[model samples]
Target: MIINKILNVDDYYFDVFMSISESLTGFSVNELQSTGLAEIYYKHILGQIEAATFTEFLNISKNILENSYTQDQLNNAIAAEIFANASTEDIANSIITLWYLGTWEGAYVNDLSYKEGLVWNVMHSHPPGAKQPGYKSWGVKPVNSNI
Candidate 1:
């Protein structure tokens, strides 16, 4: 039930983000947004830290979305090249890195909130202090891992 306040766009924008993220990260929206991570990404791109921003990243992503490509197009090598190159852009790369590591661009900025980071999700491990895997399961595989 969380709503976006920064961009003021409708559901389509989130859908775009979901689609792009699924393509890039190979994770479902239900999986990725379970802890409101995507919205945080949107906030980061909009104006979280001002100088630390991704307006250009969002623009390039939206431009790709605007192109005449089908959902299947994102999986192709050409589109992969575009995404790969776009991710090289400062903001876009940070976004991709965040999607993978679930942290902000510490290489660029020191502020990083790893509360719901994707690495823990993918590794089938819970956030260190938030959700304990269970009793004495430190090295055991997570019971509910989707990866």
Candidate 2:
């Protein structure tokens, strides 16, 4: 029998949370990491939900990731396994909202979170106040903007 020894427990949990977030949000690990909110989100989740529920959710996510064969299969598994349950669904939804809107339960985590929201990038734009595209830039078609 192999023994599991995790010296850095927080890091391990963060890794698992990140993997689950990647699957739930359809974003790459790098993209999630780029936001610099992985740890913050993890902490927020831990604070918002019970520890036992979060642990079980992580385990289910691990199993789903291990068993899934394709994107469609993974999505199906996620919907059936995660979204079907009320507690897990709440957590999953919160995670998605956090990524897209940079808020947890309708409250922004921080200034960086507002600026780094994935929705802005998904639309090939930046936050309104932060990262302004320059004066009158909107009048001309953006170069190489696929959108």
Q: Which regions of candidate 1 deviate over 4 angstroms? A: 1-11, 48-72, 77-88, 107-113, 136-147
1-147, model 1: which lDDT tens digit per residue?
121232345644565665556556777667777746677676565554453234444444556655636656545532554546744345545666777676664632222346566677667676677676778786665577575
Model 1 scores a C-alpha lDDT of 0.57
Candidate lDDT (C-alpha), each: 0.57, 0.82
Worst 10 residues of 2 by lDDT: 1-10
Clash pairs, model 1 backbone: none
Give the Å shift of residue 39 in candidate 1.
1.5
Per lDDT, the best of the predicted structures is: 2
How many pairs of residues collide in each model?
Answer: 0, 0
**Per-residue CA lDDT of candidate 2, range 15-92, in tens?**
777777888888987898888877777888888879989999988887887788788888899999999999889889
The TM-score obtained by model 2 is: 0.83
